[model samples]
Target: MQFIINQISSFLKPDLTILALGADTRQRVSWTQSQKIYSLSPKKDLSDIRGFYFQAARFLKRAFRLSPDTITFDPHPNFVCKKEVDSIRGSYFPKASLAPIFHHIAHAANFGIE
Candidate 1:
């Protein structure tokens, strides 16, 4: 139950709604168009991935109101979340496009230099 949820909102017009999922370490859930989420991560250790999953799932169902047209997730083969992509997608965005993104690139795109 120890985690952090930070939502930063802004503006950026986009054709399709996009959801960006972070790697296991930061374990964030974010989106584009800037109005929904800035970044959502439960402040916790990587070793406790089980708890992370539960919290993530709960947060996903609770906070999200719209389904993204595309879903992007970290593709680390070893991470539990990577393997659980189906459940991660779950009733949340069954029709969304799911794609794999490199950890560094994904982070840079969102948290990188301007």
Candidate 2:
């Protein structure tokens, strides 16, 4: 959390923040009272916290005047609909180019992504 605060503090007055989200293997499960209890039991996988991560990303984006875009399984594993990506795109950068950039692969080029 401190890392996020530091990031927001360092951004220029006007800057872009791209936040992304994805579901982990653990999150690809059904939610139940037992699951909640298990989660609180400290025996649940921390990997299941995908939802919170996305939530935090959104929070930080707003705090730093940034934009958020998330990625998730196209045919989501645990849900009937797969719309987070399109929702984010529509809400944040509706007019921005919808180019498919291999972001992770371009971690050293211009802006750390060509």
Candidate 3:
């Protein structure tokens, strides 16, 4: 997340306004409305993640109407492995701007004392 934030702060020019689609810049570390998410956990049976992703993609296609650039959060399969960075690139986001935000980085930073 810090990496993404840094990219936004550093890479994007000051004049260009950044419209974050799937994330809430206000909350920073938490979820917020208007940000759509599709979670595909093998454990859960109710919400089919892939199905939802397709739906979101369709919606985006219509909503964007062929915008120049788009950024999204698509986790890689190697997210569980030590190589949390590479998996998603091979599987999902070969094209288009994508960011991999590490949950553990945040968790470890916020770990509570027992």
Best by TM-score: 1
- What TM-score quantifies how close candidate 2 is to the native fold? 0.33
lDDT of 1 by residue, 72-114 (tens): 8777888766787677677466778888887778657776321
RMSDs, each prediction?
3.1, 12.2, 11.0
Query: Candidate 3: where is the Cα deviation over 4 Å?
Result: 1-46, 66-70, 74-95, 104-114
- Best to worst by lDDT, what's the order? 1, 2, 3
Q: What's the lDDT for candidate 3?
A: 0.29
Give the Cα error of residue 2 in candidate 1, in Å.
5.7
Query: Taking the candidates one at a time, how many backbone clashes does each contain?
Result: 1, 0, 1
* Candidate 2 residue-wise lDDT at 50: 43
Model 3 steric clash total:
1
lDDT of 2 by residue, 1-114 (tens): 222121112222222223323234323211112111001111344543544444443544465444323232334434322434455446543543332334243223224211
Comparison by TM-score, 1 against 2, better one: 1
